[model samples]
Target: MTLLLLLAAAALQPAVEPQPSLAAKELRRIPAEEARQGATAGHGSVYAIGNHEIGRYDAKTGQRVARWDGDPAQFPHLNSCELDGRDLVCAASNYPNVPMSSQILWFDATTLKLRRTHSLGHGHGSLTWVTRHAGAWYACYANYDGKGGEPGRDHRETTVVRLDDRLNETALWTFPDSVLERFSPRSASGGAWGDDGLLYVTGHDRPEMYVMRVPAKGSVLEHVTTIALPTDGQAIGWEQGQNRVLWSIERKRTEMVASRVPPVK
Candidate 1:
């Protein structure tokens, strides 16, 4: 009778679905002094992002073309950047400081000059990455466990917010448990919506990108798959005009690396 009951319980349990994995192929590396935070590609140029500086390099020649330096007091931590039309939209924050605050900085892609700033005053963790998808803006607010964390919240509180054209929050969602486990102490540092209609995000220092989708029934994002990358994560950007090419940074080497990411099945 005991054996029969155990067998019945096992039959009632759901079968575990295998998690799919994909590998990104490294394409090329470009040395950029400002590649400490992240990199973005657009308009025949690749921009290397630093805390308060940005260097634009020729994507084909790998030669430095233009550079922009901002006041560190105003722009302390520039986490990541993405190319949107004629501008390079960047995520900035006052990290490792109490009461985290974030802002969105836009620079002219041609001149590499600061064009505008929109302050997203303290509330939803440090803004790590932001991008536009399907006419809506998606932003990642990262909450760390130790250094840059707040009083009550930790990494588990990291969130993704959707905003309208004017940047008003419309909806919000959190990461899945499995993906959150990968970001235990440090939170997600980069995120972008892929052309394939999936969201790809990277953790603080992992050489992996989690492919996710907004769940139809919950406030948590669904983990669809994982992709292995060549560079340890800080911030990532998808190359403009390229199908599935991603641009990331090698912080230690101060280099910008490009990888061809495979499509999820």
Candidate 2:
């Protein structure tokens, strides 16, 4: 697929190692922030999707691979998107990725052809990335309390929806009120699962990082913690100078920042 990657200012904020998985030893990243909604990675490619459009970049060289996307079928909105195994997953939402009426589209990575479409019933939120954890797939959608425009992403509630055989929200895990109260009623944005099996979620606008263990049961999810995030969208990326792994932070006007996860040793 043809890609158009545009590079900009590069900066690496001091990094701090978190856990066994989010440790700076595991990831590599470059500084290219877009009000970055979501990130998708595969082979030698990485996708960073936002409200403007989608971009494909060389994960190794940090070069623009391509840009492909359009308007939402219903509203003029496209939330976040991710890559499943060998396919490209995208979500278009007027209300965070919800709506029994709206759908999430899966396209072929090589051909970019529309393969399958799944619908999330009403009450769903702005869909971000489709995460695969514990041999099962989950769709990450954020419910926002903001009004509109890019700034709206900052005020949202993240919804972790469990898909049934029919791609329905059989069981869902949402942020507890205590965790939500830590930050403003912000929107939950990009999230990713590490090789360590821990699920790291970011508040669209909240200044804290929410990490949750793929709980054995829904009720156990209350253990989710809120760590300070330098910025929004603290998902995953390579720390520029240190060349490590980290939960990348969302940038305001530019792209997201690939802050170091820890001090370079």
Candidate 3:
């Protein structure tokens, strides 16, 4: 196979982790109020997370209650997260590395404790965002070329996949040309299932979210609409309560922003 083809083939293999060198740590403290990449609210608490750490806060008082720090070399690159029942499911990847690999990291919603790590054999793209919807799981596999060691990747190479409950791939969908243009070199950053039955997603740095839905008979998702967001980051969350607002973290500000999304027509 050609060099580019070889890389593409390697991307389909299972993710590999470095040898365990140090033990992961736990702390009952707060993370730096900035650098937050994702957020989720559940179990009477709110989680603010960065690529390096995760913090739990009281839902009402917003007071930091617990924290967990990942080994820098082990649990790096946590992008976005969503509350799956009592667990916080996060989409993580090894960026700046060639043949990007990814993992689905899970945490206990009440304690912010790491519970499980599901390696998503690097196939779809570079799993940037993942969420469960309608009895199935949906994931965004992102690709970055030129700057991120993926020189073979063009703007149109990214994709989203539907998986069974066991996380086995079932189908795949490519973003529309217009949405792919917004991603450019980077694929979708954040994704969540909206209350309106649409899959909402954000680009790496764009301050807008794209709404998409699986088509009845096609490999490409149907572009529904776009909504401006207050902040941008690598992942997004949707509040599950009656308010039903959207949540995102501003990595630069290290802060979380929430907004209400109008139901699609």
Candidate No. with top TM-score: 1
Clash statistics: count for each candidate: 0, 35, 2
lDDT of 1 by residue, 135-230 (tens): 999999999889999989989999999999999999999998899988889999989889899999999888899999998887999999899999
| Candidate 3 local lDDT, 212-251, one digit each (tens) | 8889998998887777666654577776783556667667
Better of 1 and 3 by lDDT: 1
- Off-target runs (Cα >4 Å) in candidate 2 are 1-35, 72-75, 96-101, 110-114, 146-158, 214-220, 227-230, 234-249, 259-265
lDDT for model 3? 0.74
- How far is 235's C-alpha from truth in model 3 (Å)? 1.3
C-alpha TM-scores of all predictions: 0.92, 0.67, 0.84
Superposed model 3: Cα runs more than 4 Å off = 1-35
All candidates' lDDT scores? 0.92, 0.54, 0.74
Error (Å) of candidate 2 at residue 244 is 7.9
Off by over 4 Å in 1: 1-20
RMSD of 3: 12.7
